[model samples]
Target: MLPHYAAPIWLKGGGHLQTIYPKVLALPSVCYRRELLSDSTQETVVAYDFIDAPQTHAPVVVLFHGLEGSSHSHYALTLMHMVKQKQWHGVVVHYRGCGGVVNQSHKAYHSGDSLECEWMLQQLRQRYPEQKLYVMGVSLGGNMLAKYLGEAQNLALADAAAVISAPLDLPMASVALEKGLSKKLYAPYFLRSLLPKATQERHQGKHPHLHWDHLLASNGLKDFDQHYTAPVHGFDNADSYYRLSSAKPVLRHIQIPTLIINAQNDPFLPPEALPTAAEVSACVTLYQPDHGGHVGFVSGPFPGNLQWLPQTVLTFFSEHA
Candidate 1:
């Protein structure tokens, strides 16, 4: 059964405030043992292990961070803190070219990059062969996780999975980001990192044939994808990239018990693109709450904390009855 979520009156001001609320709150600072791991392609990716969690026998909770997010992200810290309280192990796997380091490969991580997901989880699975392994992915990472689950079918990289704020339909989510308020708030946030990374890659003589003028002057993600991401990753254009990267089309193929949480109030995704029960397999559960803005689930009195999101995920993971 899905836990009911009610947005506290004080936290209510719609998705924008709820979404932005987590950034201001004083989240727990997890003492993480940073581990640098290499993928099958031999490209370096970072993983942060909760130093305090009992690694000997406890279940390992693996997290994949959102776009441009790292193990130090507010959500990561909060979730890992919760894991520590439960005496479970937690690890946040950073996407390539993320975690404050430019990766070695020419291509940056994308919404459909399931191979990396498989590699990282398998590596961890091998390390903790006797313990239960579970996984969650947030936002862009969530999308990639869903994609991986669908593509891998019953491969069982983890015992179960949860996805938070994943934009399953990449094209539709891109359109939602173009909405007036979303455009103003998020475009700058993403472009800030994306542009600089592309610039650094440019300095390394990558994407020399791309439209340098337009790429440098990119106004939003669409523009950035068109000029840089699409070409660099071998897609024809932004539309093609969006179309192929979406996980929506493959939901029915997933054979594991996967929970997908998409807050209806999230401004980053269009409600129309949300999948219905008929669209997914029996093992996939859709937990579409009416609140919790774009990965933000804040609840409490004066200065709120981000317990709802992590609690929701942990509850779903813990319930065996």
Candidate 2:
């Protein structure tokens, strides 16, 4: 059963503030043990930061981060803290080039990069065969997790999974993010971090043929993904990437228990884009709260914490673990 989420009095109406508030507020710091996994391409490495539970037999939660996010992300740290509190192991998988280090290969991660996720899951399963394992992903990571779950079915890498604020329909989400105040506010913030990484990759001779200046001047994600992400990753364009990567088409194939939480007021995904009961498999649970903008589910009074999301995730994982 889905829990009712009422936004705090101060953050009830505005999506932008709800989305941005928790990110700016301070949270507890988490310590991690970094492990580098060699990419199958052999040109770059993916970094995973592990936060081990005190007990060896505790269940493990594998975390996949959103675009440009790492173990340092607010949600990631908070969840790590929660996992520690429960004496469960947690590992945060840093997408290619997202571990505060530029990847050696020209190819970076995308919303549909299930292969990398599969590799990480395989590693964890092998390393801890006896321990129960669960997976949780946010935003782009959530989309990739859903794609992996649907495609892999019974052979899915984790026992159960949870996805939050995923842009399940990539094209629609992209368009939504590029429109209105979302474009004016959110796009620029993402691009600020993205452009520099693209530039760094270019300087490393990753995509020598492309015009670096033109790529640097990209105003939004669609433009950037078209010029760099698509070409380097072998997609024809952003549209092709979105078409192939979107998780919405494959939801029916998921054979394992999965939880999907989408805030109706998310700035990046319109309510119409969310899936209906007929759209998902029997094993999937779709929880749509009236509020909780984007990844934000801040409750309580002023200076609220993100304990809501972490608690909800842990409870779901506990039931299925």
> Where is the poorest 10-residue window by lDDT in model 2?
202-211
Off by over 4 Å in 2: none
Could you tell me the lDDT of residue 67 within candidate 2? 89
List TM-score per model, in order: 0.96, 0.97
Kindly report the root-mean-square deviation of model 2 from the true structure over all alpha carbons. 1.2
The collision pairs in model 2 are none
lDDT of 1 by residue, 1-321 (tens): 566777888888888888898898898978888777875577555545544454588888899999899888888988989988898988888877888766777667788888888988888888889887889999999999999999999885888889899999999999999879999999899999888888888888876789988998988888988998888888999999889988888899998788899988898897888888999999989988788899888877779878877887888888721
lDDT of 1 at 71: 83
Model 2, span 1-321: residue lDDT tens = 445678988888777788988888889889899999877567888898998887898999989999899998989999999998998999998887887866887678899988878887988898889998989999999999999999998999898899999999999999998898999898788898888888777667677867667678789888888888887788999999999999999999999889999999999899999988899999999899889998999987787889899888888888986
